[model samples]
Target: MVRYLILRTLIFVGCLALTWLLGLRDREEQLLAVVIAAVASLVISAVVLKPFRQQASADIAERVDRRVERKREKAARSDEAVEDAELRRPAGDVDEGGSDSDFR
Candidate 1:
């Protein structure tokens, strides 16, 4: 991701420099120059940075998958613990009171 950002920045700067060199240095032309540079950089990066983009995407996906797996494992462990506690409770114990919501 860092590499992709750096490369994309370089491409934008290069395009901006090229536009300035082509006579867009004046204040009035600077905006146009920036717009053109941005568009050109976007197009260039989309084509040239495909691999980097893919790698970054894969990295993000892997991170998300790992996080989800960790959450799933945690939930499974919690459920197992609850089940175990339930099994250890006295079978003769019964709730004869009102619903818990009544306390609230």
Candidate 2:
């Protein structure tokens, strides 16, 4: 894990260094681009890889337990998602028929 982070950070810095060495006379934008790319990569890695890493640390049995718990919670809440009462309310009040009152 430590090595992976180091390697990724090194790559990010390397890009910045290379751009500078290659004489990007307008390096302000070039460096900013690298910073943006690095931040985006970090955000994506955090969202995607971080969760998977936690799962990887656990034994198979533990992982399965966590997974089954998640599934059960998801299944329990499944009905409420479609049962949002406001949306299910009658549309009679909405007047989608486009009568004369629409122009008024």
Candidate 3:
């Protein structure tokens, strides 16, 4: 993530520098220079940074999958513990029906 951000910043700075060199900085409208530089940087970075973006996305997806897997395993273990507790209980203590007859 840090590497990607650094690379992106470099691209933006490069574009801004190029725009300034191309006489945009001499224009009366300073905002125009900034806007043009930003747009140019955005377009170039979209193409140049595709691989880094994909890698970041994949990393995030893998992390999420691992977290989900851990949660599922924890839930499964909890369910198994409940099942084990039910099995360890006395059979006579189990009530299959909601009636007072079972206690009698």
TM-score of each candidate structure, all chains considered together: 0.88, 0.31, 0.82
**lDDT (10s digit) by residue, model 3, range 46-87:** 999999999999999999999999999999999999999878
- The candidate 3 region of ten consecutive residues with least summed lDDT is 93-102
Model 1: lDDT of residue 18: 100
How do the residues 5-61 of candidate 1 rate in per-residue lDDT, one tens digit apiece? 999999999999999999999989999999999999999999999999999999999
Clashes by residue pair, model 2: none
Give me the overall lDDT of model 3: 0.84
Compare the candidates by lDDT and give the number of the best one: 1
lDDT of each: 0.94, 0.64, 0.84
In model 2, what lDDT does residue 93 have? 46
Task: Report RMSD (Å) for each prediction in the order shown.
Answer: 3.1, 14.0, 3.5
Per-residue error (Å), model 1, residue 103: 9.8
> What TM-score does prediction 2 earn?
0.31
RMSD of 2: 14.0
